[model samples]
Target chain A: MTAVRVIAALALFIPHAALAGEPIGQIKTQTGTVFVERAGASKPVAIGDRVFESDTIVTTSGTVGITFTDNSMMSLGPMSRLKLDQFKFDATTHNGVFNSSLQKGTLSVKSGNIVRQTPEAMHIRTPAALLGVRGTEFVVRADDAS
Target chain B: MTRLRLIAPLASALALSACCGPKDLIVVLPGADGHVGGVIVETGGSKLVLDKAYAGARPGSGASEPVDVSAYEVERVFAKALAARPIPPKTYTLYFVSGGDEIVPESRAELDAMLAEIGDRKAVEVVVTGHTDTMGSSSDNDRLSLERARSVEAQLKDTLAAKGVQSDSVTAVGRGERELLVKTADQTADPRNRRVEITVR
Candidate 1:
């Protein structure tokens, strides 16, 4: 939604539903009609479903909670859309990157090892904002429904 | 009671703005321990730093200044999303006898708490890493550590399966004397260093 950056991030996460990357996280909770779109195909999500890079999460009057490999957590609210643009972690060193974009609705995040090991490693994008996390819990709401 | 009633309208206005006013609103929240960090919000050419608990900003307006938000406003606006947060990952340590693979009786129950937590999530992924004190030969320590790890793994693998926790991701590894929790001279025995760590996600 922040136009350039968000659009760019979404572009990377969409269409490639078939280009499934390795599991970067897992769905810890799912309620109602949450769907995951991968490589241009959409499927309903389950509690233990693995989330990968380039995957788009769509919540149609539903909610979802995900925990990343580095222990980062994110929750999406009803009528929300989010994309896992990319994620990489080196368990040995606890260094990693996490990038995601929120197109609409609400998201709550708790930063974990990736951000704690490398403070600039995690970022969340929105229609009008690009957020750089510094090891904290935060929330964001986007009204533009694209 | 009368004064509280008088302040109700102002609270309503805050809730309204919090729910429907900004095109994009970012709020920094305190951690479970009440520690607030910071978030840098970047717009076209401006940036705002929200560094306080309940501090809010609107990126659409390119506002560098943070607006103080009440906890009530945040709860009213973001109750659903906040409620959906996943539990944090956790690590548990099980100590071992310095000379043998026998686990100290007290730390054998590290997995019991984890077992109760597994039901809340779809599955549990476990990594059990074994370590040893430096009092033995490298190969012996390696074997001892691995045996220690296997014993713990045996306790978990079947118990979790019997409980229908749906986890085939349980694994064990031995670090021998390579990764000591407390660094010490060679051939020294330290109870603290002789341990196994279980991580659950």
Candidate 2:
């Protein structure tokens, strides 16, 4: 009974650890300065930095572009704060979901196979409105200044 | 009330992000006053012109009440700022022979075209997916499809490395006969159904 319990515990723990280590995307380009906040720690964003779900990317005076696992690309302009809220893709079927929030500033996105497989799979949220990506490319800007 | 408003946006943001639909394009243009005057959002045969500041929108759903963007400013500065950003993603598809990982002879030219497209980019990431016809069992097709995808991925990595272009990541997946391009009955061998898709960014 004890051995079985330990085995079950290990089985549950292993997959969670693997999933947590899976990188959702990578920072392909960064000009000027960008930072990523993950798990409460903030670090400078550099070229080739892996981005994960729940990571918040803040760009102060430069632009940063990230290409996700599903081949979707997102470029953030200066003074932007974006978060990868959720991303799930089945590479084989090219079916997945992508959700992100743009707190402020400008963002341009080009949908990948996931969106081509199903249009509703991509969604971007701005401070004032929700932009459901139904097209191959679109630009969004969220301004909170009053 | 302030907190409630903030929470609502957050919750709705999550909700809105969960849905999927077909592709649509939206072009936002500002008025002479520097405020977002209207937007041209289109999908398929439908086109909508939204003149308000805020709007609840989705592709193919036509339009909803305008959302509040009173604080938003659509200026040339913002447009120019984004225009200077990085290159967009590029994708190419090449078909393969039935039940094999080999590319069809006719599609051999596409590999060069694909490589040429990524040759000039400073940064790159590649993803390859393989598919197969339904002639084989599911498990066998899965392995064959994966093998096809891996073959393309390996070639892409080798070519890029030989050129000294460092790819951030090269990932591949075999989807078996699940996502058929030509939707055929089981045991039917369709040439189009066997293919590999490569996406570079």
Candidate 3:
């Protein structure tokens, strides 16, 4: 943990911020922990952290809420599992694509214009079904088979 | 008369099954308790929901209020995804470095497994968010939170890409230290406050 912290701090010093178009500032959790990870690595998410596809973060308890770059909001409730598979946006074309899957637990989602523009571009999956959104907020939960 | 009696039972059974279709199932809501459970039944074009009111009462959080889960909440649980049957919600708590975006190394294996579970599903929407403890200035906290969220977002996109999942399906955001699990605002820095949250939609 300590080692990762050192690296994360170092990252802020580098000019990578220009490359990633990263958030305006430091990313944190409801618990007040700062965010850190290798530039191309996924950070593990905890309660209060907004989730994203590139990080591939997971939780062990409770729920987390997320607001995407396009202003879409999603919430994940306890024990639920999900992954941000892919997301790409072209501001000029107004084309933003996002996809993910929920393995277990529950999630509530509110889609925005980006998702509405490319309806097929938004996707969420559960243990028994796959959700394709056309701009709406929805929830899903699945039990752990194990 | 004999034919009607036999047909009546069959008709009723069919009707019941119809009401129990996959789209009609209701999900269990998170309770104050540690565990939460819910049930879903299909009714016409809508859904029938059954949930344990106080089933999620956590042991030490003061008194366990009667579980007041709303039918709408139950609906939200199932409404997040599209499926034919009830999908139970799973929970995970993440531990992060203080003032940083790194995850505990030991948690990787579990995280990897969960990632795979979601990655294999082509239609899922992944959400990643970051939060902060009450220890720092709100301005700094917000910056830290977003940085953390972006870091996770990068990681998820990279990992999934390696695993053959497309990278364009994920979304990431930062929420700063606005919400806390333990509620330790004015006094000290709570370790539990340092964390991030992930969800599926």
Candidate 4:
């Protein structure tokens, strides 16, 4: 397997861990393993990877994306500072809600069936705006011009 | 009391974050027959039609139960009689009042269902774009569309707050009648086409 796949593999079972000075967070991907480190940790995320929490930065080593158990997908752009502060999804009833904060950069989302099932459960935050999705696809950006 | 004390810090943190963004609840509605409930279009029957072959949901493993989709001519048909049967894919088109952007109480149930999905995520993007029917002047439609979008945005914020979904990651837009699902100028005043489109990202 490639290095990225190897990292993805190690990510899943490691549990939410914060290094000596890292922040708290988790990352999951499609067919890829899950990995997490606290904010400021030197860990890198690539395509098909995700990170959930505050104070983390996305470096160029890997492109990261997040897929909630309910099918909602968010792909973070390169060099972005995004955190998944909260997520609760119950597949039994098709109920999954999420809240995310974007301190900097861009992220694209293709929401899943949960929004159709429950619109109020989804929200996206940026410096200048707050976006509420009801099961449609869109992108949000925050940068110098934001 | 010790347990409560441990949880107090989390609760206080959540409360403090409430002002940074929106706090709303996202709810999911069950399906009746083949169709999931809460659709805006008036249906001939309460049962919804799901293209069984194409219907799919994620965190995908739970839907692997055995159900004969081809037993009948209809690819997929579930009955309201079996409340526990899995829900199928369906669509809903909400309508708004004339010259008003407020979503009626009746619509709250459906909105609640949508919010249930995204509110759980630590971070999500909800793109709520508003629309208006082609009955009024362009300016009026513009204002109406904005009002409608704002109304939905406010409702989402309030609902999320109640459900423990903090704000800070939500936005709303007013598209007016620029993008109508159905053109009313050529057809009747179809309430179905005049409303907002919420895309949870």
Candidate 5:
């Protein structure tokens, strides 16, 4: 765990704005080694654990699932790495933006309110592809080299 | 040693490629409701739409193929990821009495049943929204609606706490006459319009 934290932190070569506030989501299910890297600190994530935007989730020989505030769902397969880049929503208006990056491994998603009725509200970034999700279910896979 | 390490990974990658399909790929799956939505996968200055169930494409490739990913391939590739999918959210509606914040007797029973369905979940989020008919003044209706929503939100949070929802968040809002379930003129009352909507996730 400690070694992975070091490598993951080093992998974030670019600086980002400080993110702190209410949690934007929570872990709904997890098995084996599931972690959330936030503010340069790495910690294990259990069900019900709050996750904020900009948190990088890493899974090693395990899987993890999360439900965002807007009701979107994301699940990561084994040996996967994902970063929740940006998320903002107004439950009353159902307007928001959802963006994330999958560095490697596999991901499955179900679009939520923020993107269900609106177009171009959700995007998932991968090494070789950028996906515009339109209120649907999809799966993405990427190897490290890609 | 460096040369051997490089060659070893290359050999393993080649062996893995023989069985695995693409280094970067995407497949659209049918939703829980059986609706197969679409995705625009942009790579190498091109965009490909995967609109049909099990449709797939490879990123970074110049040409896009309308590949219909087979069930066997989907299962073989993303079984664990699919299994990790979270349960979808559910919403329930309960009506209130005209000019009163009280929940109708029949709807109370329904609320009880709704509680049973979500009482055991972890990280439960409940949103209770109160709405009313256009019978009364908008300001008065807004206050009544808020009271009605707060009433249920309090009852629910307290009950859920006792029932031991692992971690929960409750939000209450009032839509009042601004949004009516049943369209009506001013000073009109519709039982259907006096209601509360609850969403559990």
Candidate 6:
């Protein structure tokens, strides 16, 4: 635990440039195994790890939760591959766009300020169809059997 | 008569299923300042616009019809997101007295409000940027601005700690006269420019 704390402290000091991209959110919770693929390189996702746009998150045997800058939350269940396709928000105006694609498995989303400011700003895509959120919570699950 | 009885039961079952509804994607919004405007759910080239509470299925999905969810259900589905949600970044401006780090009396209320808002959050990130009017030498303004930012940061940190709020990060920077809130000629004393801007997230 001490070592983890040390790493978390050090992480705060790491220049943003070292992270190699614009951070859209951070991993909030992880149970079991989770990996993120960015720039063609895959790495294990830690609790405080930053997630950037275009990053693909795959959970092999557990669940992972991520919170975006807009305070939106996305949780992925086991055997899920979720992509942060696009995220853009204006801090001042609190208006932005949220778009993601769920390749497989179960995922849940809670809308944030971006949707609050304009309800039509969010879009989620699955192999079966595209989803547009109106201002409430919901869940989706996709499997090959369906 | 036997066939009619069987069809009646089947019809009732279908009605019950419709009432239960199909599971649609949920998008929970904030309930602080009243209901958010609404959301649009689109599928298979068709769109369903939900402006009130909840939307169950996409239009033309042939599954369940879209309907409004109660405020109670909205809160329930959004519980997790609400708990993990971060306080949005907000900027508070406090004007300074003439040439010193001391804030103007009128700005104290703004400072207090900012502190109160910060106290409500469990975790926060603060950025205090100090600015100066185009008065005196650039070097002097630079130092004074930084001093002002430090002052605000110190007070903010103390208040937040008292409220059991953890400050993830606190940054103070002095913009000097480079970025003026109001455009002014050199040596012009503008109270609006001589201010500290505190942003809390």
Q: Could you list the iRMS of every candidate?
A: 2.8, 9.2, 13.9, 18.7, 1.9, 6.0
Which regions of candidate 1 fall more than 4 Å away from where they truly are?
A1-18, B1-21, B119-121, B129-155, B171-190
* Tens-digit per-residue lDDT, B60-104, candidate 3: 123223234466656545443332221222324566755456778
Residue-by-residue lDDT tens digits, candidate 5, A29-101: 8989899999989999898888898899999999999988888899999999999999988765567899999
Instruction: Tell me how candidate 4 scores on lDDT.
Output: 0.49
Model 1, position B14: C-alpha lDDT score: 88
lDDT of 6: 0.70
Task: Kindly list the per-residue Cα lDDT of model 5 for residues B121-186, writing each as its tens digit.
Answer: 666777788888898789888888878888888777668677666424777877677767778889
- Which candidate would rank higher by DockQ, 1 or 5? 5
Q: What share of the true interface contacts does candidate 5 keep?
A: 0.76
Tell me the RMSD of model 3 versus the true structure: 17.6
Model 2 / residue A87 / CA error / Å: 1.3
TM-scores of all candidate predictions against the true structure = 0.77, 0.68, 0.36, 0.35, 0.82, 0.54
Q: Whose DockQ is greatest here?
A: 5
**Candidate number with greatest TM-score:** 5
- Clash list (residue pairs), candidate 5: none
lDDT of 4 by residue, B104-161 (tens): 6777776766667654443444556677767767677778776777787786687666
DockQ of each: 0.42, 0.27, 0.04, 0.03, 0.48, 0.18
Cα miss at A50, model 1 (Å)? 1.3
Candidate 1 global TM-score:
0.77
Clashing residue pairs, candidate 1? A1-A127, A2-A127, A16-A39, A17-A38, A17-A39, A17-A40, A18-A39
Of 3 and 4, the candidate ranking higher by DockQ: 3
Docking class of 5: acceptable
lDDT of 6 at A94: 62
Residue range B79-162, candidate 2, lDDT tens digits:
544554556666678976654557778787887777887776765676687888899799999999888888877767778677
List residue ranges in candidate 2 displaced over 4 A. A1-20, B1-77, B95-105, B137-139, B155-157, B165-168, B183-186
TM-score of 2: 0.68
- CA-lDDT, candidates in order: 0.82, 0.71, 0.52, 0.49, 0.83, 0.70
